[model samples]
Target: MLPINRAVSRGLFAGLALKAGSSTDVAWARACYAIRFQSTSTHLTDASNRIRRRRKKPAFLDRTPFPPSPEEAVNNILYNTPNATPAPVTRHVLNCLVSNEPGVLSHVSGILAGRGFNIESLVVAKTEVPDLSRMTIVLNGQNVVIEQAKKQLEDMVPVWAVLDYTHGRIVERELLLAKVSTVPHEHLSEFVEHEIEGQEVEEPESRTSFSPLLGTALQRQAITELARLFGARVVDVSLDGVILELSAKPDRVDAFLKLLKPYGIVEAARSGAMAMPRSPVDGVFEDEASLEVEDDSGKVDATMLPPG
Candidate 1:
């Protein structure tokens, strides 16, 4: 079909030819129509070619390789370095002071979870200031990972401050409560004798009647002595078991648990570590400005920390 402009032009030219009444005029009209049609067709063809070119992919795309998958890309960037060895992971203790509000713990934990970190132990409780709370987090990670975690935690709105006491001379302690069997194990007999430092008394035939009671008394004595050596106390005593309580450093708590293992620990609970830096002087507290400066420097003043 002819375009409107072409149809109108054709009609006008034909009318002129009829008025002129000459074969030359008619042929001229036909020639002009053909020229217009050819030009239109050429213009339409060029436009269609341009559209097709625009739709085609770029030449570089054909030569360029597809991007690596997310997992592969991460591996290449983080793990595929030349002569790179894995960073050594060590335990880190981070103390965060946060506002005492609901869901604060969940928010902090969610951040760590999103970053793919596992919290070994977490202890949260109200600080001396009623409006603020202290959260102690224990985790094992490379130094870089821990530092990144600290930065992220510090960025949180509820987190007022983050203190890393892993390398600092802080007084850290954990509480352990273990329910151990009152009946002593045979293996612990030698240990008991060594710890108690008293020889057993031989009894006559008539006195042998009290042997069972004597054995029970000796067992209690052994347990009590072990507790005293570790600065623990027997908090509860029952016919079958005794609850021992110990508040000490994490390593000492572990050692105490190991010592009680032979006696059949029925149940045990340990409060995750809580820590504070030693006071520089008696009854004097370090202010927030000094704490901030220490945090920025990543070092605790040796003079501020009391020597052992």
Candidate 2:
């Protein structure tokens, strides 16, 4: 068996305690668990201080809580709440093609971080050609906010293409590293609430595009009509505030954005795009598709097993 991290082992034991059996040594087990928990914290802190001491610089150490195993997490939910079902979290992956240039990564990260979205994982590698890099960013946000982020990215000068990879067709992979911070229970509720609300607001976001009008008189009239008509908040203003962004249905967004094209506009940004499959083949069709793994038989066959 692989060595279990302290957090995982401790969490498992904590879960097991809630399912105590009469034959078990409850008092002794509880006492042992408490001691182990304190010792682990102390060791971790001491190790951190030692490293800082050697370096002679103050450094903040980040510690990550171990993710619960799927079974353990399910057990925790069922045991803690006998009546409620734990809803599965929806996750999405996005593939981005961008000009391989300086500041592109920073530009992308800025857009996501500014919107309070958490990027779960990211992988960047050069594609088959020079000066082109492919990026895979895994993120968790409400469907709305993520879509908005994607649209905003597409509008960015450096981005060539952005594809959502959650659906089946493309090969998708990401690398993740995390640091944990403990927040008080009261603060946690507020933080989580803010996250939820932000997601809800971003979901219905849509954009409109318009063609430039033939004459200046008609273009000015169109802009005025749109500004007077739309009730959604203005997220962006382009073409000297003639082109506007308003949260609305897909049709409304299209009508509003399209009305601006006749005003001698060179470019416009409609930042409400979300990643979904152009077709159903974007994700796995059945269980068989997921069970397939890499062709690793040759690699494994060449290695000798250690003596038991």
Candidate 3:
């Protein structure tokens, strides 16, 4: 893991020192080579330190300088006491800033696959800014694996930053689009969509009057009431029934689905949890910036915006 310059100098020193010569001549030659290598290695190490100090800082919480020399990282690990036990496996969400180009994703994904890491979920999309894309990956592994993945990602020329969201406080969310075959048309409540708009799930929603003229008004009204309870909204209604959309924690979504099963679930799509580290302030969702993105296709991809 020596720097390239140091490695080259060592190789030259070894080659020069191995040459046959008279006893005195050999001693002088070895001494000269040793001195030369030392000087070269020192200069190279200093240059490496300068480069590392100038390495772009990741937006992540850690501000530690990138390793000045790869050898130093190895030495640190070799001399450091090992943890009592290998870190237990845990889920981690990693966000990587990468140049928008072909094969970058394949290169990154290949590295993890080669290392036998399991990627539970992965999302790749352009960011709000131009050219730079964000790769959000969810993996389950020990702390050591996570560290290896981050280092590997940082090594790639196209990667600008790799932030381990799980290691720090973060704002996390998941989205779900579920289609159910039942529309609570029984209750004459006009519709739940009107109520779902412009409201946070936490805030109380006043009951909209059910349309008395609608058939099965009471049943439909009850269904609308329950949908509101589960923080669901009718995104679309047609012959297939109703499309309910919601965003919440995974477990909450599970509960919501379980309750809606009697309504006949036709299909569902969920965006695996996306996360970003919280700011220095409190963990309030409002304290963080949203990650809404729109590509050249004119399609808005809402990974995780502020939940309201």
Candidate 4:
């Protein structure tokens, strides 16, 4: 079959479209024309021939070889914490830009699954345009495995870019939504008054006494007030409790939960860290600190992270 270049293929299709009203019809005529007229086999065959005839991979002066895998020294032990033994494995986050098409995620995940790397957390969402998406993937692995994974990801067609934000100084944040309890509108003021600590009270009046249901209401009221102080927004309310949502640094939010321990916590959910590099100003870094494992060699050691 003869090969059809872009100009010839488009010209041929244009002629077929003009004859759509004919008895043969567009679909049938188009299929016949495609089978008989438009061909790319010869062009592909020539390209394959050129590739086979090439002697060796081209070399450029600036080409840098991929880093070789390193072997551990006899006393290469590092500590994750001051007293902790046997440092934990490192985790890396890859931000992937991909075409918004079906099976793209499956293909990306399949590669990770095959490599035996554990995915700590993954968030996939569409971008400003419907035809593109960003996949933020967190995975645990050795340095060698991490580099190899990046190389493989770059080779896939659907993947447009894979930027690693693991070792860099990055800004990361997470979201938390909690279902907390609160008192009904009626007993709010009394519930609020009793929560104040060291309030010496004499024998109470009849109205001061709280019933069984009111006791639960008091507990819920304390919880709600605490949530409010943490800048949490009330999302939903019911006869029992309210659903509150908040966004904060992960560690600070963890501390907030510890403060809520006095009140009964019903439910909570958290998202994995969403991270990006801090903006640079005049070629200087605005954010300076980075989390690192302290090592004698002053190299990148696995800084153990608390499990999600």
lDDT of each: 0.81, 0.59, 0.72, 0.72
lDDT by residue (155-266, candidate 3, tens digit) is: 9999999988886777777788987754453431333444447432232254464332232334445556777987888788663256778887667888988887876677
Regarding lDDT, does 1 or 4 come out ahead?
Answer: 1
TM-score of each: 0.57, 0.30, 0.50, 0.52
What TM value does model 4 have?
A: 0.52
lDDT of 4 at 297: 45
Which numbered prediction scores highest in lDDT against the true structure? Answer: 1
All-Cα superposition RMSD per candidate: 19.9, 38.0, 33.7, 33.2
Candidate order by decreasing lDDT: 1, 3, 4, 2
What is the per-residue lDDT of model 4 for residues 179-232, given as tens digits with 9 covering 90 to 100? 765554445455556556545333345777765356665766777687779887
Least accurate stretch of 10 residues (summed lDDT) in model 1? 186-195
TM-score head-to-head 3 vs 4, winner: 4
Report lDDT (Cα) of residue 182, candidate 4: 55
- TM-score leader: 1
Cα displacement (angstroms), candidate 2, residue 58, comes to: 90
Between prediction 2 and prediction 3, the one with superior lDDT is: 3
Model 3, runs deviating above 4 Å: 1-87, 183-223, 282-308
Model 2 CA deviation exceeding 4 Å by range: 1-89, 173-308
Clashes of each: 0, 17, 12, 0
